[model samples]
Target chain A: MSEIPSKWKCAVIQLHSKPMQLEDNFNRAQGFIRKAAEAGARLAVLPEYSLTSWVPDDPGFADAHVDREYLSKFCELAKECNINIVPGTFVERHVDDGKDMLYNVAHFISNEGKILGSYTKKNLWHTERAHLEAAGNNPHTVMDTPLGKVGLLICWDLAFPEAFRALIIQGAKIIIIPSFWNLLDLTEPAFQRNPRSEAIYLESIVISRAFENVSCIAFANVGGQKESGFAGLSQIAMPLMGDIARAEGAHEQMVIGEVDMEVLQDAEESYKVREDISRPDFHYPVYAKN
Target chain B: MSEIPSKWKCAVIQLHSKPMQLEDNFNRAQGFIRKAAEAGARLAVLPEYSLTSWVPDDPGFADAHVDREYLSKFCELAKECNINIVPGTFVERHVDDGKDMLYNVAHFISNEGKILGSYTKKNLWHTERAHLEAAGNNPHTVMDTPLGKVGLLICWDLAFPEAFRALIIQGAKIIIIPSFWNLLDLTEPAFQRNPRSEAIYLESIVISRAFENVSCIAFANVGGQKESGFAGLSQIAMPLMGDIARAEGAHEQMVIGEVDMEVLQDAEESYKVREDISRPDFHYPVYAKN
Candidate 1:
């Protein structure tokens, strides 16, 4: 295992992708990655479905052929920029028991252009349930990297604390969530009380997850207007400092922040969350049978 | 089971208790309960350690003899005010096997003065772990009440999402937390960045829990100056409205809000979080063997 850096910078690229325009989306993402790398970021993460822009109904959107080429481009970019990359998610088509199925997948690439790990989004959003198959019963994806153990979760998985808990328990020091959440996710009644309800949920949960797990959280979300329903609040949050850097609004931007192991170590000494969870006598009941 | 009201008011009584002044604290808590009931609140909650304050080193603070009488007084107040009560927590000294042990415990009392259920705080704070025994391996306490299936958690337990998950999985619609969180809980380095880090944690986690679980979270915290470390941000939050009512600062006051079942039902329909969790194929890894 390589020695982990004690201090480094990370960036979340909040991109506004053109729906179904793969070339335009890739070009924009590449530009953001270059900017992040130039700004001294060792890791840069993009929003979920950045390549396809979340247009599930578009013709040939789920084609498996496009995914491999798109990932190869991201790998080449990682090597060229000399930065680790989490290039959002792409739809994956696989055959299981003679039936074709689609899954949303994300990959981690090293600066040397190695595919470190690949994770299929386990908890699908309500709408995605209709078109995508989740990787149920699979363990959370936690990969050992030069930055320390890193884990990945997709948009809707943010709502489930269990996913975060599973990763942290596996010794993940940094958890990255690539999200495509929007303001209009909530219903009409909820919007009446607070039009920014979804935004509040995204920000609060991201900060809370960092604090509670005593880990760093990099949340990258898409950018657009309220009418476009893109609730952009991309941020890099730490346990004690909350959001060290956050996007100002629903706009295409790169939010960067320092990820210091010292701060996390101090937080652990103060809170001892991981220590408590590791105690042999510690237990919390789980009602789920499977 | 009794008929649960579709819409009802709940109050979080944020009190500043005098150390070891049980009588004065009881009187103040009773006054707040009467005021809440008069304001049409069907349920009222108090902060943890409200009766004896948080002086753990005080002599006779954990006496078993005083707890029963203190709880009886709360039951009497509940019947007199015609409101359900969660009168914070008390240090309970119980005989286990051949030894005596101390556990931090909370209870739910009906308007009829019946002790519906009792919950021993399972997740003890780092400091408390030295003196208090946690109720490890015990299932979370959720009881059927006129307000619906209600659950209880105390103080530091708020940091552990597993406690909330256990109760919600058992069908808890309303989760009440009695907290004694303080602004000075974070280390010096953390405070240098933001002195309000603990406050942010309390508020964000409360709102996030309500949103993610699609349940009502009523949080009652103590009030005091920053010098005293009290980070009072008592709130009543629901699925749709993040915080229907909240205390403005570290001050003694009662925050009341309406818990509408219709709004929760609408959120459930829109988010379908509960539906997804209930799916047979839903699974997330748990590394803990116990």
Candidate 2:
């Protein structure tokens, strides 16, 4: 087991990114990282597609191979600010068996600026399937970090609890999700009953994941109006306290909260969720080993 | 696939049963079932341990083998009232080999008074483990019923998403949970952080389950004060409109809501969670076939 700190602070930076504006988005994210570091946050997270936004169709946007340089800038920022970072996700073009394939990927960076690990989004949103290929093998990414054993997931992946289960089984204590989730994701007829369906889904899912897995979840989502397709509600949640810190609305801001290992330990003792899963006699669904 | 009705009404009867008062509890449950049927509900659910309140250590309570009689009364009530029922859970004593074992079990009864299926609680609560043996084989119960494909799960089982996944994979469209869940489930330190932590957990989990599975959830919890260990938030939740009807507070009441198959179909199409899981190429967690 990795040595985990008793208490540490983290921040979810909810930012609005302009489509196709890589440098501008990076600079804005950099500003948020500096601010979070100044606020004594040991780890900071950014929203999905923070670099080039989520315009899937534009060939120009797809051709702009900025993932490497974009990641380098985030690594430099992490080292400079002396904090760990999850630089949201960027679209990566990989040639698989002579065909071009695009994958949405999120990376975890250490405070010393080393890339820890990356997770390609396994569950793609309906529209994104047309443009992006979901990760085919060993999709879950859980790695040791200065913050603790951390796991990484992306936007629509939040809807699938199996992804979270796989990570928890692998001993992920702090799961960071970088999402570009939007309220408009629901159909019009469905939304007619409850206008805040997606909002409820985001809040409920985050809290449920924390409590069920007996872990902490830091969700960073883009902020904007419903028309812009951003459901901000970026939040930091632990087992007992659902949302210690959360974005007030769908607006650009940094939400900060503390993760106390003592409280998490107490919850583990009270709930025994991890213990139950670990027992050889107790049967629960887990990802089949490849 | 069973033909599901376009629209139907259901009721979650939040009842507080006196400890060991099997007769009175059955009478009260029958009254509520009649009320629900009068209110045009096709199905009605009761809270766990409704026949004998959850006094785990009472030897007298354990020896009182009322499971058969209690279920008989419920089946008769279903026939009389013309309503399907999930009559909460009962302690069943079954002789395994040479020893007697107690199991916490829930059942699904058709409106015609036939027992559709029974599910023994697989994930026992910390306290429940002492008195009840968790189901060791085929824990999930998803059966064809008048209400289409329905699933039955007991209280603590809600904490494990894998349980829900198993049921959904078995073609359950409406999941019913009979819970004796209480706010006092949390430890002192957890309560200090958020006194309403369990409430948040119950509500959030219900909504999250409904949304994530693209199915309807009827959670029936005992209603009473925190001292009594009843966290009554009995609710009927569907994908888009979470908690269409929920208990006003921790009180004895019947919460009714309409379930529209059309709305469920719309959600299934919008989320495509079922479609994603059904695709053999999309690897997700499911219970190992026995």
Candidate 3:
């Protein structure tokens, strides 16, 4: 086995944003990221819809949504703390649509105050879709940083395998997901239980993403309830295995972990995860293509 | 509401199998399908690799595989039992290979012992890639029978939404997945904690499939270990729900349940599972399509 590299500690900032309180949510997020940095975490991830949540259909949210100024403020904080921060989703103003589009976004800010690329949530949750306009284009892109190739995605995107596969194809060694996941009952209760905790399905997708792509996945979800019954439960998963570090119960909290790129090497050597074990011969098409 | 179709009982036959043992396995599967039919089931589905598991390492599997004779027996059984049977998969004697190439296949048989159409497994599992040959060009085909436009796929195909979408495009109102699901630790533990004693992941897939396609899904899994540590645990899941009838414990067994085709219409109309709620605008592309 190859020698393991110096491990990088990551803090998953799981918290509860009392909807529409921009200042309060920012303070809470700032506090958690600061603690993670103090604990020697090289990077930290915040939850989805954290920037300007309380803004519902009411105009209050329109006034409260996070803007360039808010992101710049957070960038200044990242510089001050010398911690790489993965700021969760924020309602931002789009260039094309002057109207505020709820961008389930993630910002990668370096400890040295360098602003990395931001990832707008590719797949929006149902509620978010109602309020936010879909990102028409802008495919999954990776940011090359000291911490290896980092891929970013927002909440509901994790449910789809193809989205994550796109990130992996872009040479992302670590995939970060910022989420605002809600638990709810489906159409039929007689058919299934555990409606409130779709965590298992989420975990499976993350695990498969990591395993197939051979990349580390860091998922940071906020804890606590908003006007809508969204319970926060942030988690970080290593490549090939799901849920490396997870916070239990719905509480305002943050989870910290490390992404050792060398682990990918080890898992590959041990498990042959990338080996095309899929039977392409049996794939659909009906007739053999020469 | 359009005059509701008469309530039809559908059985999802989970078929866990040993690597080879074509004759014995075929006989066992026949018995279960017959039992399900006798119990008033109008449709029955078997699991992937039911005819012959793709474990290429098994010594007896290569030569002792089932052929025309075995299928002839199944045809006879379907006729005698007077049931609609979907044989999960079988290793067929390749017309050209002569030696015996594994074809992950599904056979649709009528109550009158007539062979309806057959759909080969499209997406083979990763593990099978090591031993089993890839099946080229299998398209999503639907069987227009009494149980609605029944779409059929093997195990891995479910992972790819496009495959099921093709079936839906082809007018498949219901999908039957005959699978040999390799159980992990979490599945058994989750089942142990549940009243129905079924894996949460299995239920998740069934519900997700039903929701995404707006069709009823009846998935049959193999039970009964041949060489592997665990095998049998058959179940039947309805649209937008979970397993209504399932087997218990870790042992091999047959399970049966009824799926009301009307549930699809109900889920689509009042529940509006896939259409009303599912917002594909937020979709992420996983694979790089050519």
Number of the top candidate by DockQ? Answer: 2
In model 2, how large is the Cα lDDT of residue B181?
90
**Candidate 1 has which clashing residue pairs, if any?**
none
Give the lDDT of residue B262 in candidate 3: 63
DockQ for every prediction shown: 0.52, 0.69, 0.16
- My TM-score estimates for the predictions, one after another, are 0.95, 0.96, 0.78
Error of 2 at A165 (Å): 1.5
Model 2, which residues run further than 4 Å from truth? A1-4, A288-290, B1-4, B288-290
Give the C-alpha miss distance for residue A280 in model 1, angstroms.
Answer: 3.0
What candidate 1 keeps of the native contacts, as a fraction, is 0.58
Residues B90-157, model 2: lDDT tens digits? 88888888888898888999888999999898888988877888776656767999888898898988
Q: Give the DockQ of candidate 1.
A: 0.52
In candidate 2, the residue pairs with backbone N, CA or C atoms under 3 Å apart (3 or more residues apart, or in different chains) clash, namely: none
Candidate 3 chain B has its poorest 10 consecutive residues by lDDT at B281-290
Candidate 2 per-residue lDDT, tens place, A1-290, comes to 24657798999999887788888888989998999899899999999988788888877677655548889988999999989999999888999899998889899998889999999988889988889898966557589998888889898888888888788878889999999988777677776766778888887999999999888999999877756556788998888778889999788889889888677787887898888777666587577323
lDDT of 1 at B76: 92
TM-score of chain A of 2: 0.95
